[model samples]
Target: MEQPKRLSRLKTTALPTSLSDHAAAFDRLHPQVQRWVRAQGWSQLREVQTRAITAIGGHRRDVLIAATTAAGKTEAAFLPLLGAAAARQDRGVAILYVAPLKALINDQHKRLEGLCADLEIGLTRWHGDAPQGPKTRLLKSPEGVVLITPESIEAMFVRRPASVEALFGRLDAIVIDELHAFLQGPRGLHLWSLLHRIDAISHSRARRIGLSATLGDKQHAAEWLAGEGPQPEIIAVDGGGAPLKLQVRAVVEPPETSPPTADLEARSALAEIARHAHEILRGKNNLFFAGSRANVEALADRLRTLSEDGGVPNEFFPHHGSLAKELREEVEARLKEDRLPTTAVATTTLELGIDIGSVHSVAQLGAPRSLASLRQRLGRSGRREGSAAIFRGYIREPYLAADADPLDRLHLPVAQSVAALHLLAERFVEPPSGDPALLSVTVHQLLSRIAERGAQRADQLYRAIGRDGPFAAIEPGDFADLLRGLGGGEEPMLEQAPDGSLMLGPLGERLTASRDFYANFKTDEEWRLVNQGRALGTLPIVNALAVGSILSFAGRRWRAVAIDDPAKVVEVVAHRAGRIPKFDRVSGEPIHDRLAGAIRDALVASDMPAYLDPVAAQLLAEGRDMFAALDLARTPLIAAGKDTHLMTWRGSVANGLFAVLLGSVGFECETFDVGVTLLGTPSDEAAHVLGALDGCPPIETLGRFVSNLAHEKYDDYIPEDLLRRFWVKRHAHLETDVADMIRRIALALS
Candidate 1:
């Protein structure tokens, strides 16, 4: 069925005359929805709600709801969706709700269960942890909204292509939550390819609807969501909420009066924090976001110890991806109950919306990875009415020796956190970048599509996976080269039989058999952690464990009874006071250039940020003094003893290119925090190298030194030439002028 004739009017049209018109739009929704709204005791619709009703209900256009968290973003997208479903034929699934995280989908399914039950709309969630019963039931009778993750969608395409087609034959809409999470990188590209694949298979023009709280660039987000279709009518809503309460404080390892040993001082610092946490956060619902899972474990354990010492209940819990689903769910259940005072020390696992009730405060152990993340973490708190969002940033930088690098010793962590808060205070968020040649995800899709449909012609494949695909930026020549490389190599992934049909070769079949092929996201080698033959969770192989090893996981200690190789399982039993095993949490998104520049600005600026505590203020002053001594603004290049550092206030991609360029010219370089460091070359030698490149060399020429080109799944199958081309296009900021960089280095040497 075609959208309403006046769908375009919703874009270039005037507003409704009065409040009655808006109310009439709401009244148009099914009576069940109206009753549900009344049962909730909501007086009126929010801005996004009204806008969604007007655009989706009246105009019938694809919609992108961009609003703040707790602004009823999910409701804004789903209200129209379910209302439309109410009038449609319930044959196969009517709506497909895709979330980035399984936890998010599970949370939404539970939250919407009441409404879905009230409307009698069948709702089923399918993810890794979800029981097979719902999936099997949905397969038998696919109807209503099906909540899933992107990986699960890929799995459905692979495992039940025919079922997927039948199920989504008359799909009404595709609702994407956390849309910003899928705007860039392999996951985003994978989602785009999956959507296009679904469209091709089902032959249904399901209207796409995206819901997100943080979209850096609205135009880019709209284009990303729309793809080849008409641009989604963007509904940007400003939620009026209470002001934010932000505080940044610094913790020195030891007191200034009596200096202690590093280990002792570290212990004291942890103790001091636990005491402070007890005073400020005890007996209150809150969350603490640590820099890493290890930190979360260490801190939560310390907090538990403190509670035990004080004869109080241990309300602290550690939450991360490695924990068992049962434990994580238990944490969620406790938080939702909101009876006992609880605090979850976590990584980004809990940052997204999970409806775990209102948190009184959200604390950070260090500076957040990005401004967008900071915004999301802040949104987790202050969700209740009349309550201001409270954020406390604890920046702990152990004291370095007096002769240590001034830049490192001045405790810049707190300053950077304060600077980020300043940006947050101004409501400055890093816009999601939509443009990137995702050859990695393209490779995954190429394999997946071919697997779905036995053989695909080169032309049709190109059109469906390239030109008309998410990787539109990828050139035809590069795509052809990639195919030839994958099919022509000694270990070929594809073989062209007689009839010119390409099919998976022996190597391809082996790859497809692996369980990890479903996901486009990069993950480390992990072992399943089992207890008495029951699965507890998984631990990264990098954690270094052997049979009989005892470690802490899931907020409990366990002894590794056995390590089964073929089964890839580590059997463990309960133990006490086990050593905290080394575990790694994948790094967050790369730092944006704006936030990096803000940190640099904070170092040079004279004004003291009001959010900083006395220790942080003192550190900021010292950092300013050190920066002045080095005169880094005019000359970002500096000599720190034997090493020469080129401080490029640019992002990781740009800094990476700069390092590769220097290495290409025989100056071995490596990327450090906010700059590139010449590994063995002298400062003067670095200057000479930079001065020689007055007419900067083409970035592509430096690809020879660019190791690790095969960072993605099938990147190894990509031809070297095309891989380098794609890398330079995606990573190297060649669009930026290099003349300024060259001049700065030369002047520093002089």
Candidate 2:
């Protein structure tokens, strides 16, 4: 096979260096591509698009396109990439697009349908929901672009290892959408290993392109995208379109009457928030980001009820992971069509760019998770010219009774929201962080490689999945220990043959055969929820539900009719009222130290944010008053009743580590958002203990105090020593933040 003429030209041509040269880059595109762009009536390419064209069309170097949502990142990447694919001389998939969510793939498929059709480039979506015929057709004559998710790629390696090279041998470009989503987690590691494996299999020096809306550090993101390949050219477009219009509203919950009435008060507070959301967002195309699935259900139900009582069309709907795909799709379709006013009260499932069309505004129903998320969500709005990005933040603070905890008195939720807003205005976003030794994903890749190759030597496995692979943090000795644990145990996941080649043991074979082997993340065991024979998505089996129990789900109330334990099914019927059902899911991202410190600053500052409404302003004032009264700026440790609260003003991780240290020293303690609570310990005793600390404790010593070490799916299969190491590495910040926190506390006490 010979090199494509376009590629050969790109290799020799000097890349455009300025805006004046953008036209020359555009001219370098396929003639038909230029015609198509002209037909679209775009007078000029966006800065991101222009830069992408020069970088991608001119060279084989990896590229990262960082821009806000609705900035035409997809077009920027594809216009140049598809040009290369169109000019390819050989058959096979020329361009591979990977996304974090299946919804994103589906959205992109629709987005690129017309363009791909115009170019006569076959576009095939390979995911769980995609049809078999198209996949089979792609398998027979692999060509054009293939849109896929990481899990599906994992599945390909396991199920169709023989076809990997044939399908990807001639690939020219690999594009990763929502690049930030794959930067930190087991899923990211899994994708990284898969990419290396693919490279090893096909030996195709594919150019990587990453598209992201929110990247705190472009260099770090570029590093992640390129892996061990050449440094990627970074095309970062500053400024999201339009001015931001923001406001923070507070809903103060009634004081707790008693332990029994606390739940009712909580419901009342939520109802008040829902009322505020309904009044402000009714009859508009907006998104209300309720933080969790439970909040989504509760807020959506209340909004729907408010609509009913007011005799208006119920435009509010709940969108979460548990909702049925069709139901979620219907909501998405309604939003995209823009025929009716739609507001999706949703969780982070809607945080990604799935093309829900132009949102009038975004309502954050609780404290914003992070500045990055706030920026991303806000990007959905103000896409239309001359429209400002509108943001409404709703914060619920306690009534701050006499008996309220010191943390609650500080009004952390409201302060966090305000700090996040201030950071957003300053254009700050938190960088991604995670354990480098994501051994759990390593286990997954090891099993997958074994299944793919039938057998492998231990050294080869380490090189492929450990030393030269994604799990580069795993040392040789620790890796050997991990392998011994896997192969020497009674129920071994691996077995060594006489030739010293490792193959799957009985347990490993059984595991790899299951469909669940493809994903490295942990998913809850869920029960299929059905109402009148229609599948209403699934609910995690958090607890047992009786026949009479009414559950709030799918933006409606339902009465439990029957439970099928064997089938993992729950039958329900319409009901008048219900309580929000519990779902086994973590609520928010870990608060970074910068945000936490910002929150503290917000509390102590006298100047108020102009974005706060009357209620929010009052809450901030009260929090400031409390801050002054306690002199928390100077007094790091304060006695509140029997508990001594040590205000670390640090992120959750540091505070958690502090609490663990306290617990290890025979002082009962717990971690709140900003500090550690030494239960029943006097302030003096706590201060003395903290002041005497020289440095962070040893990892081994800290490991003795930690529990529930298994966080990942394959963690249970790992040996206790390795599992403990993984946990400590992921959770503890001993050398940096925790050490600083220790010294700070000691200094404050002294």
Candidate 3:
């Protein structure tokens, strides 16, 4: 069905009367919609909303409502969508609400339910968590909006492919929420392919509307949201609710910890945080983002213990994927009402806008993985007029060297983090890079599509997907590699088929696509720690964990469980009472590489940055006195402290290169925070390291560390195959202009 024709002059009411006669239409909105808008306290329509209504509602284009969250984007997209559906479909779900998380769909469904309840249109949520009854009704009646998660929609795509044509025949639009979170990674790519396929089967065009909060680059995001460069109506939000109030502080416990000692472990930084959290989160509603789900569980237990000991009500709660959905949802709902005196210690699960009430404050337990996350957490605070983020940073103070960089100071990391947040909040991150790991996700999805379709012809399948689409850029070589992985020439698609026909095999089926095959996000490597016939969730199977050691698993301490190599399982019995710090990842992309350099420059400029924190003040004073005495900052090779110490502000990777280069010159070099310390002999070694490194000899002196590596996902897991791939790739761009960056550093230092 086509959109209703614009029979006469249509103009926005707000437009001046002289021009209104030719083009005003908004003032003519149905009386009920006008009333609804007024009651909702909307003063006027947003540009995105007006544009959507104009381009889509007025002309009926396959609209793409690409805008940020809390930008009234949901209403803008849906109001026109609902209007379009009202004109045509009275018998089926006209709108499909698909989001990555169930919480987002739930939030949208409820909001729409109130609006459409009396409009004779029904709303139905379909997901794994949804009851079978409503889904059955939607299948039977095929009316109203069917809110669903991507996985559930993927299931429907397989189980009811035939019904899809009928169910979504008049499908007006699809509203994808929290789009930025899923759209780039494997999950987004999978959804995109599924959507393209859904269009193929439905025989109806569904207007796509993607909603997100953090849109770093709107143009690129729009391109991804609308496949084949659909000329999506780009809707950059103008007036988001409010700006963020951010305050980052690092709490240092009494008694210094230079070299890690047993007593320091007992009195950990977490203890100091627990002390402050008791005061900071007393009256305010808060959400503390712990980077790991493991940390969520551990922090919950700690908070519970704190409440018990302090005789205060337990306001903190654990929230993540591991917790039962019912429990998690209930907690979330309660949090929204502001009646529940609770603070959720969560992973990124709670990061999206799920309307968990006007939180008075937000807390980050430790160094966050990215500046993007830090900004999101900070945004959660001061939702009302005058609230601020109670961000607290905690680091293991015990593990330190005699000469730790000022940046390692507890407060310095937080300060640098704040600076990074400022850069990100302004919407920049070295800009967005194209997905390098997209092939992995594509492989995952291809396997899933095959599983669902049962058996499909190679040519037909490839044509259906690759022709005139995002995969158009995908090469024949990569496709061949994927086909091979899917049990083809080298990798068998099915067990018996040497010809590599597309069939789901045991190997291909074990991937996530088998589980649902829809989600493309990377799964973490975990070792299920089991003890005494019970399951402990999982421990990160990193080189960070060693055998014969007692470490925290889940919330309790367990002795180095028997490391089952084949099973990749660790079996252990409870040991003493100690906990390992559960950190999911430590990724720092400060505003720029210059931040580290700027920090060093700041140290030299004045004592202000050094004396900012009490503990850092003493450390800085000692370092500065030493620096002046040795004249270390001025000279590359200085003997101010009675020995030759090389000071280079070339950053970590470069400093590491210097160390490797020193070895090339036959001089063993040790790296310190400020510079490199030459060991053994400096005369020949110093010349060798510099000659080997500066001359750009990949393997002349350093031998095989460059090409020895294959691939490594984890920092410590730099396998021989990985390490070669990483540094060669890591400094790939640097190879072009690094001479200048290095030369500048060398000249300045020299």
Most accurate candidate by lDDT = 2
Give TM per candidate.
0.86, 0.88, 0.74
In angstroms, the error of model 2 at 6 is 32
Between candidates 2 and 3, which one is better according to lDDT? 2
On lDDT, the stronger of 1 and 3 is 1
Write one digit per residue (lDDT tens) for candidate 1, span 190-289: 8898888787866558889999887777767777888778767888876756578878777766534445466674466566676677678988889898
Superposition error at 365 for model 3 (Å): 2.4
Q: Rank order by lDDT, top first? A: 2, 1, 3
Quote model 1's TM-score.
0.86
> Scored by CA lDDT, what does every candidate get?
0.74, 0.80, 0.57
Tens digit of per-residue lDDT, candidate 3, span 1-750: 432224212222333223342134356454455566677786577666666566655653345454443456787777666655655635667888887777777788878876676455778888777778978877877987888877777676666766777787767777787777764545666677878877776656777777766665555666677676345655554444465554444555445556868777446667666666766776667888876776778777777888899887878888988888888987798788888677888888778878775677677765443555655565566556444444554433333445533223323344344334445445553334433334444555566567667666666666766554456645565455456444533434444345645676665555533554554454555667788878877755422222333445455557654665435566777764334223211232222343444435544544333213454344445445554564546545543122234656444445555555444444434444335555434434443334334534553223342221211222221122323343344445544344554454456444
**TM-score for candidate 3:** 0.74
Candidates ranked by TM-score, best first? 2, 1, 3
Tens digits of per-residue lDDT for model 2, 401-488: 5666665666777888888888887878888766533878888888998999888999998888777634777888878988988886
C-alpha RMSD values across all candidates: 8.4, 8.6, 8.4
Worst 10 residues of 3 by lDDT: 708-717
By the TM-score metric, which is better: model 1 or model 3?
Answer: 1
